[model samples]
Every structure is written in structure tokens, then in C-alpha cells.
Target: MRTPHVERGATPVNVAGTGGHARRSTVTTHERIDVLLSLPGRSPEVTIDDTDVSERKHPHDEEKGAAKLQQEQSFEESSEETTYVEFEEGDPSNPANFSYARKWAITLAVSFFSLIAASSSAAYALGFPSMTRDLNATQFEATLGLSMWALALALVPLWSTSFSEEFGRQPVYIVSGVGSVLMHLMVALAQNIQTVIIGRFLGGAFGSTAAAMVGGTIADIWAPSERGLPMSVFAIMIMAGPGLGCVASGWIEQNPHLHWRWIQWIHVIFYGIFLVTFPLVMRETRPGVLLKRTAKKLRKKTGNMHYRARVEDQIPSLATLMYISCTRAIYLLLTEPVVAAFSVWAGFAWGILFVLVESIGPAFRSVHNFSTGEVGSVFASMIAGCIVGEFIQIYQEKLYAKYYPTKGPEARLFSACLAAVLFPAGMFIYAWCTFPSVPWIGMAMGIFVIMTSLFNIYVAVFTYLADCYGVFASSALAGQSLSRNLMGAIFPLFSEQMFSKLTYHWGNTLFACIATLMIPIPFALYWKGPAIRARSKFASQVIHK
Candidate 1:
């Protein structure tokens, strides 16, 4: 059979199953990080306002009800009538009802852990000078350590998310947290580059828990309305982590006694603190897993063998969700024009970040004759850029709220439209600003500008796709996440080579020109998005719904 090629806004097919699903009139989880900083596994089914979730009216509700009906019909019944269990009204056990202080505490802790994970990825690059020397590795090989970590980060979520959903986020957090610490330890003690590379891969695999799972935990604990702030903080942590890591490790690499190994050791110390306190602080937040545990206790105490959690009755295997999420995301990437366009745009933006990671040290160290510590200090501008973006987001919101009723999702495109021009503009600024005669502050300003542009791009892509796809939003976002991470992983391997041969001026210029080419994308989508989406079969499903 010939494989069919999917087209942009052109495939007029209604692939149904999640048909009749209405988007949560209230769940705004996508108003923040997810597609930019995506949830890898089975995201927690969210909402606490309604005790009888099945009774709630929305897009996903119909899908859930349809799935639940099928499960109830096939459910094996014991001679003792098996009754389904769920959180009751005013049930104190429901995590969503937790006091604001407690909720914030959980949010802060997990977000911090996730911050460390993101920091680890970029900080590994800052250590290249020392690590490559001591391990007798090539630039490409040393880069592999970072790339390996990213590969595992992108792939591990395929299964790790299943574990988090199955056992609970806390247990998975603890186990992965400890393993993450050990991987850092392994890298610190490595005798060769091979050991270092392996350590980085495992560190990222274990550390993968921090990124996706934090998003899951947020959804688990916060009601739909309450999630906006926490989710924003979580996104900040992920984006800022790499810059923070570079700052610290750059300084550490300069210390004669410390060098690269200390970079790993420092994180080991941080992860150790996270491991010890996390289990104490974060309760099992998955409501389904918690409800299942409650059913077990009730069955044992009340001597009722037939008590079962309603969530347990219809739980799809991890493999099934993984298969659908991975395949469908790929399908969307290939077939859906909106998903394809935004994903490519977001993916390149993410790749530029990694390119910066590889090039920053050399760019500053050689040109400005900066010390390792000073070069690292330069990365702090990324944080500053993100801070600027957050404030811009406030204005974007004002525009969004004021115009959203009339503009629809196109309201999001306003910032993206500006970001599209700013993105390549920022790259051009950085590309040209690299002269020794020019003050180093110019480079720093360029990084800050680039990051701000990226921040807007991330927010716009994630939110727009979420709005367009409805019940299938995760698949769309997952496509974005996959491409972003893959490019993120692949960019560094070639970046150093490009920078070395083309020179920083032209290498970044090439990136800027490519970014220039993409500038029209958001503009095109903005003017014609409604029309384009109207023609899309998958998007049309959500549009009609």
C-alpha cells in the first residue's frame, strides 16, 4: 500500500474517536509552558471544582465519558458487586483543595528541581574546556555528552511518564532524583570521555522526570483556574535553568582546583538536597493513583473486595498512550500544516539556544579574552531577556484579553509577529556585535534580545496550537516538543564546526538569514489562520466542536 502524504489545512478528513469532545471551557493549562516546555508522558487529568468530573460539560468530557462507558461494559465483575470510587465533594484528600501556601510550596520545590535539570544540560557545555582536556575528547565528542543527554531527555519521557502515571509522581521523582544525582557523580569520577558521555545520557534520562513530571504535578494539584501562575513559574524555571547553570559552571571551570568535575559535583549537592526534601514535601499528586490507593485501603479495612477506583477501570496501558502520542504527533508534524509550521519555527528557535550554548564560551573567550568565569557570567543575560519577556507577556495578555473575543486565537499572533522580526534581528545584532573593539556588553544585549524574542515565540506557538486542536492539542504540542528537542540535540554537534569554519560572524548570520526566512510564517498564519484552520480536517474537528 502506498503511504498517503498529509497536507497543510488541506486534508479534509475527520479522524474520529475523540469526536464530540469539547475543550475544557476552563482548563487553561496550555496558557503557559507545555508545548514550549512540554509534558512528556501521560499528563495528569486535571480539575477539582467538580467532584463528579464525568458530569462536567466540555470537549474532553464527551471523550472521557465515551471511554468510560466502554470500560464499564467490559469491566470484570466479582460476585460481590464491585462499586467504582472517586473523590467526593469536600473530600480533603483531593490535592486541588489544598491551601494556597501548601500548593505554592509544592510548586516551588518541583519547579526548582526542574530548574536544576535544565541547568545541567547547558552547564555540561560550559565545562567542555576542562572535560575535553581531562577526558582526552574531541570537540564533537565532548559535544556528544550534551547531545546524548538531550537524546535521552527527548526519548525517556516515552516510558518514564508511564511510570509517573502508574506509581505516582512522588515515587518516580525520588527514584529519578537519586539516579540523576548519581549520574552527576559518575561524570565527576569519570576516567574517560566514554564514561562522561554515558553519565550525561543517564543524567538526562533520569533528569527527564523533572521537566515533564513537574507539568504533570502542576495539573495534578491545581484546579484549572489556579494553574496559570504556577505553570508560568514552571516555564521560567525550565528556560532559566540553562543560563543559571552556565553562570555557575563558567565560574567553576576557572578555578584551578575545581575545573569541570566540580560542575557535576555542585549539581550533585543540589540534587542531593532536592532528593532529601522532595519526598517530604511533595505528596503523591496523581489523583488517579491516589484514588486507587484509597480504594485499596478501603477494601482492606472495610473487608469489601469489590471496591475499585473509577480511574483504574479505564486506565490505558502506558504503551498505548505512548504509541498514539508519538505516532500521532509525527503524523501531525507531517500532515498538519499549522503544527508543521509552528513546530519548525519553535524547533529552530530551540536549536538556536543550543547553538548559543556551544558558541558563547568560544565567542567571548577568544574575542574579548574573557576568563572562563567571565564568559559564563555573560549567560546571565538570557535570564534578563526572559525577565523582559515576562513583562511583555503582561502587555500581550492585555492585548489578548481585549482583542481575543474578536480576534480569536489570532490575538496571540500579535507578539509572535513582532517576535518574528525581532528573532532574526536579534541574531543579526549578535552576529555583528562580536568585535573586540566593541564593548562586550553589545554581545550580552544581543543574547538578551534573542532570548526575549524566543520567549514570545515559545508562548505563541504552544498557545495557538492548543487553541486550534482542542482535544488533540497534546498531539500537536508533542510534535512541537519532539522537533524542538531533536533540533536542540542535533544543533550543537554541527554548531561548533560551523562557528569554527564560518567564523562566529557568518555562522550566526546564516542562522539569522534562516530565521529571516521563517519571519513570514507567523504573519501568514495571522492573516489567514482562521481560513487555513477552517480547511484543515483535524483542526476543523476542534473548530466545529
Candidate 2:
């Protein structure tokens, strides 16, 4: 398919390059932007946009019109002669052609890695009180530890997303795993709060790989039609991580001997395990990276200098691609309505996730007289909800398979459509259930329902963006991650205050009302998404393909 004219009325400039020399390529800036935005393996047709062909025909005007026409034909013929490298039919190296068991294994490995990284987010929270006492830090300073992890998780992905795009998922994950472990060790051994803060920031920065790269990994292995189940597991881990982390870490905090340092030590231990396990299980799944590797092997074997993958010429240099990736995510956040809406939805949902981390300690303690361990145990409900969400996710997959051809990307929204109502419903349950008269399990049930809904929203935002954007999906999802994680970080900083000042009832009621307002996002997209996609600058070209 002809790549659309990327933006109207601009003179073509040389594409951005990896380094100094790459600026000399014949590819235009618009075409390069498309490449930067796309997923790794999606080699867009390298044909130039059908712009004016006559502009270069008479460069010297060596002869009259007949000679100039001949020159134009020659230029056109040369421009269209790009060759691409692709897998042979049933190529074993192609991740998509991998056996079902192999695909699920990779999916599980990636998800489990993500689960541990995500668990670290709230795992620190359970130990926050002990950290503050040990470091002689204020409550606000302790809160920074959580915010810092989230801040890095949000921003580092901007860089790692592009890095993974070039280097492939496993390399990024391995490095990230190592970096994360070291950071946890740093935190565990730190003598001061500042060191702890720095350690948390760097830890989340390293751990952020799982947040961004796993989507690409899933995309690499599973085609859009089959992406639902794996995406569900990924979403489950993300939603379940905080719950699972707190489930154990709270008890660690309750232990007289183990406390905060041990919490961090436990993190280091888990990350150490993941580093050893992940590289073995998850192969290099990025098709572009793999194909480029294959091209290198062929060139070396055949002694042919001309052999190259589609991306070698088409993509910008590593630094330039990272810059493009970060900026494009911001650009999409600003320019794409679908992205912005989903981002707001996902961000608010994530904010709620962390708010629970912050508020549960106070709410459970004040209202129910629960111990730190008991408050932490409350996250078990989050796990239960995720289990339910997975079942719902399976149903969503079935519905998707049944109706994807007719419904298009909208089919992905069934879970979201259901979640929209469940969100405020769960909030209402938790909010009004705040009374001492109500059993604590009522609040626990609220958490369960909210998490169940969060799972659906999380999965839908991820898979739908990927489904709609094709190669551009990573950028699309990254834009949402920026908004989602920033909001997630910021909300908890205030959730405790809001819940206290407004009281649990009004505070959560405020959130519920906001949730009610946002309920229309998925539904509107579900009903009008195709037409909206048809009009989008980026998403339009992807879905039907």
C-alpha cells in the first residue's frame, strides 16, 4: 500500500539518521517519522508518497521535453526498486510462526517479569513506614519513594521503547533486569533517605522496560487476531502486581526483624531470579531486529555488500529514533483523540490503583482497626479481581474472534464497555461501604470489583491501541503510558489528603463521579471508532490491513 502523504504541503527533507552520515539518505522526513512510529517488524512499503514526479526531471534540463520525460521515467523506476527481506513460509525464526506452546511460554515469561517489576511499585509502600523510621524521613519523603518509582516507570519507557524497537525486547529486558536488581540493592543498603529515593528512581527506570517493551513483545509473537489471551495475561500481571506485592510485603513490614531493608532485599532477590530466567525463555522476538540480524548473516556469508533489511535504510539512527519515539508519544497524546481519551481513562484507572496503595493503609486502619499486615493482605482482593478479569478476558477473546471482521477494533472494547459501568459501581461500593457498621469484607469486595474492572480497562487500552495503530501501536501505547503513569504517580501523593479531608465517603465519591463522567469514552469509541479511525492521521491506515 502507498504510504499516505504524511502531512500536506511540505518540501521533502532528508530523513533523520542514527548518526551523522544517515542524514544523506533519499528518504523524506515524513516517511521516516512513519517508520519511527511503527512497531519493529512492520516494514512499511518503502515507496515514496505519490507526490509531484516532475520536480526532479529537469535538474540539468540537458535536453528538451522528450529527454526530460525519459529522465523522469528513469528516476521513478529507480525509486520503486526497493527489495525487502522476509521470513520464508513457516520460518521457525519468525515468532509468529512459533508453536502455540512456545508462544505461551514466552508470553508467561514476559508477564511474570512484568509482574515482579510491577509488584515493586506497591511493595515499597507496605514498607514505607519502616523506611521512614529507619531513615528518619518525613511521611511526604516516604511518599516520594512511591512517586519516584512511578515517575521513572513513566519516563524511562519513553527511552526504552525506542531502544527496544532497535535492539529487540530480550536485550532491553536483560539490561533492565540487571539495572533493576542493582537499584534494589542500592536501596536495601542505603544509609539515608536521599540514597533510598535515588535508588527507587533508578529502580523504576530500569524496571520500566517491562511496562513498555512487553506490548511490543506480545505484538511480535501474536498477530492481532490472536493477541487477546496473551494481552490479558500481561494486563493481569500489571493489575495484580501491586496486590501481590503488598500481599507479601505487608507481612514483611509486620515482622519485627525483616522490615523495609528486607523488603528491598526481597525485591533484589526476585529481580535476580528474573534476570537469570528471562533471557533463557524469551527469544529475540522483534521481527525487524531478527530480520536485520538475518540480513547481516547473509551479507557475511555471501560477501554481498548490498544485502540489507528494509529498516536499515528506512529507520533513523538509534539516538534519533529515541528522540522521535519520545516526542511522537507526546505528539500523539496531544494530537490523537483516541489516544488521549484512552490515556485519560487508563491514567485515572492507574491513579486509582496507586491511591488504593496509599489510602488502604489509612482506611483499613482507621475504620477497621486492621494491622499493617492486615492492610497489606487487603491486596489479595486485587488478585482475586484479576483472576476474574482473566476469565472475562477469555470471554472477550471469544467475542473478538466472533465479531472482529464486522466490528473491527471495536470488538476489543466489550470488556471496556462492561468496565465503564463497573468502575463507578465499584467506587460506590467502596465509598458507601466506609461505615464501621459495614463489614470490612464489603470494602474488600469493592477492591475486588474495582480491580476486576481495572483489568479490563488496562487490557482494552493496550490491545485496542495496538490493534488500531499497527506498527505505530507502541508509540500510541507509550503516549498513553506517559499520561497513565504520571497521573498514577501524582494521584497517590494527594489521595491520602483527599480521602482524609473529604473523608473516605466524599473523597471516593469524588473519584466515582469522575469515573462516571469518563464512562462514555469506550462506548463512544466502540460505536464510532471505525469512522474515527478512518479520519485519524496515524491509526487510519492500520486496522483493515
Candidate 3:
């Protein structure tokens, strides 16, 4: 069998004899036909003898032959020509190859989005008293609004990640941003507890897109070697947002005229600004999606149906993509011990953080006789700790840069080692120093240590997972996020009870003991991570470079 070769977007000029006559067919590139009936070019005319047709063994034999011929030809061509959509190592168009300034700009924008969204999750906490009084609900019922928001944050990311993977990131950001703004408006306008709970849940559900996608965006633009600083900044934003929100909402709730509703209104004002600016700053960064779009444009311009991105060939159908997106995180969570361990560790730390968010106000009020504003101001310690963590991360980055080449991704765990000890130490201090005799600054110092340690652990886990999972890092992170946020949602519901039952001293001691037990995880991973990764099917497949 001879193969026909034609230039892209050109009409077919040469024709092979189909029935012994020099048959000519003008085949246009734009024509769509069945693989059996059509060749690369436009129409082709074949001259068959009437007697030869009459003498055929079967009338459909020719059609079967044509289909077989087309299949073989397609197989041979595709086998030789198969290519994927990927950046040529130094391609400037690739997000990873973007200028340092542009990359940081994008990073900061994404971090800002993440910060605001995360802030919204805890912003309502400051207004809990006012909200309960206004809605004629108990404190526990009012707290559900916050917990429901977190539940949505955990659950909605499962679908947001799937959508972001299928469509480009920009679309998800835009749609979710708009929806987030509207949900804030809904909450601000709510007349009763039901409306407030629904609004908070939906707001968090929509707002979660930023939280879910920002890490992936960081991964998209930064190479592993240079990712430390940006990742640190990203982690700081995640930790600081809620603290900052508490600080702001504390003042808002304290104002006699502007109480709980203004918290939602305030968010609307800020989030609305982000919604307007996000489109202008953020572009489509995903390589596969960009390539697919480019391929579509090229095919349209060149009129070459065969012109396609490599990703197009490999991309599963929407159903398959959705299935994978939905289940892949759960599968990784269940099967990958490294992911599961880090997830649980991170989730526990995150849960404690949320518990503090709820308990801190009451703790300050009971221990220090502080007002709402002063209680809100106490969150500054967490914010200060986040800033301190950022500075420490600079040192961590230097250490990573020094060791990463020789140690692989495990070099990123240096801070986690220190954080492990500091976490429990901070908890111990906070637990023991809760007496009215101890100055508030003493407890603030404890929070400072704990928040700093939390930031370090958070960054390490995120960076390590990204390093281990590589291309599938988003899914791995999603699983971690699910666990972390689920804990965040659940821990706060019982925080008041835990503190009440055990008292601040015993309450935090229990948490400190748990933290102490988990300290060995980071140490174990820092030492054994490479060996463990070497043995794992998924980790072994990930290309570090």
C-alpha cells in the first residue's frame, strides 16, 4: 500500500490509479468525510469498470477495503507524527519561563486573592455575639454559620479544581469571584439566621476557588529551584488572611452603628475590587490549555484538520476528565501514605488554628477582661508571627537552595523540623500562661510562636507535596486542602466546649500533646522521604527537573 502525503492546507493534486485509469480528484483540506471515504485532500474521482463492479464478490467489499486502508494509513501516520503540547525547554511563552518581575506580579495577585478569601472565612467570628443577638439565635447556632462556610470551603474545592483543570484558570477565577461578591451581598442583606448560614456557605463555596487554584498557579509559573520564596509568601498570605480579617472585623463589630452586617459589606467592597482587577492581571497560565487554544486558532487559520495540540490527543473526554478529577484526590489520599500522613498532620494544625480563631476572643475576654476591639487586636500577634515566618523563610530558602541539588525535594523540610518542636512549645506556653496573673503579652508570645510554626509547617508540606507529586501536585494539594478544611470546619464547632470542659490550661495541653506526638512525622520525612519516594510508584514517576 502506498501512502499519500499532502502539504497542510493544500489541495490534493496527484492521484493514484484506483481502477487502472489515471484518475484525478481535487480534494480540499476543509472537507470533512468519514475516515474510510476521505483522504488528506479534497475530492478524488475514481474510474471503475462497470463490468468489474458487477464481477465483485460482494457489493460492500470495496467499502470495507477502503475503511481498512484508511485505518492502516492513519495508524502509520499517527505513530510517526504523534507529539504532545509542551514547552520547548527555553520557550519564552511558557509560564515557567516568564520574567521574574511578571511572575512575582502574578504570584502576589493570586496571593492577594487567596488572602481575602481566607479572611472571609473567619471574618464573621468577630461578629458572633452581635449576629446571635440580632438573629435571636444561640451562640452555638451562630457559630454554625462559620462552620458551614468552612464546610463549603472544603467541599466546593473538589469541583472547582475539576473545572479549573478542564477549563483554564481564568474562567474559574472570574466566575467564582463574581459569585463570591454576590454571596457577600446576600449575607449582608440577610434578615434571619437561615439566610445568613446559606449566604455564608455559598460565599465560602465560591470564594474557595482562589484558595484551591492559587497553589497550582504558583506551581505553574515558578520552577522548583526558585519556588521557595513565592511559596513562602503564598503560605504567609494563607495564614495571615484570617488573622487580618479578625482584626478588621473586630473593629467593625465593636462600632455601635456598624456591626455584624457591615462585616459582610466590608468584604463586598474589597472583593469587588479584586473581581474587577483579576481579569486584567491574570492570564491563562496552564500550558496544556494554552496549547489547546493555540491549536484551535492555528487549525482555523491554516485550514488543517490534523493540526492539533499534543494534549488534545491525550486529553480524556469531559466525563473521563471529571471522573479523574473527582476521584484522583481521594485515591491519592487513601493510597499514598506520605500524602495521608502530611494531610493529617497539616489538617490537625489547621484545625487547631481555626479553634484558636474561635477561642481566642473568649480566652482574651475571660482572662484579660478585654473588650471586642481589644480581643480582635490580639490577632495581630498571629499576623506578626506570620511576618516573622516570612523572614525565617528567607533563611529556609537559602538552605533549600544550598541543599536541594544534592538532597532532592526533601531539602525543603528544614523549617518543618524546627517548626515541629516550636509548635508544641508554643502550645505548652499558651496552655500554662492562660492565668489572669500572666500578662496578655505572655500569651501573645505563645500565639506568635504557634503561628510562626504553623506557617513553616504549612509551607513545608505544600512545597514537599508539590515536589513529590510534580504534575499531579494540584490533586495532591486538593486532597490535603480537603482534609485541612474539613478539620477547620469541625474543630471550631467543638472548640468552645473543649475549652470550657478542660479549661484553657488542660484544653491547650491536650492539643499540645497531640502536636508533640506528630513532631516525629516531619523528622521522619526529612530523613526517610527520599527512600520512601524512591519506593513509591507515583513519586518515582514524578520528574524532579
Q: Write the per-residue lDDT of candidate 3 for residues 1-545, one digit (tens) a residue.
A: 01122224432222122111111122223343334333245334333334543455875976676666667666644433422223444656667777888888889888888888889888889998898888898878888888888899788887667676568888888888889889999989988999988998999889887778887788788875566678777888888999999999998999999999999998898888887777777877777677677556644764645544544544665666667766888888888878999999999999989888888898999999999998889999999999988887889888987998888888889998989999999999999899999999988999999999999888888888988988787778878988988998999888888888999989999999999999999889988988888887788899765
RMSD, each candidate, Å?
A: 13.4, 8.8, 8.7
**Candidate 2, residues 409-514: lDDT per residue as tens digits?**
8898999999999999999999998989999999999999999999989888877897899888878988999999999889988877777689998999899999
**What TM-score would each prediction reach against the true structure?**
0.83, 0.83, 0.83
Tens-digit lDDT string for candidate 1 (506-530):
9999999999999999999989989
lDDT of 1 at 475: 75
Q: What is the C-alpha lDDT of each candidate?
A: 0.79, 0.81, 0.79
What local lDDT does model 3 show for residue 512?
97
- Candidate 3 regions with alpha-carbon error over 4 angstroms: 1-101, 543-545
Backbone clashes in model 3, listed as residue pairs: 26-43, 27-41, 27-42, 27-43, 28-42
- In terms of TM-score, how similar is model 3 to the real structure? 0.83
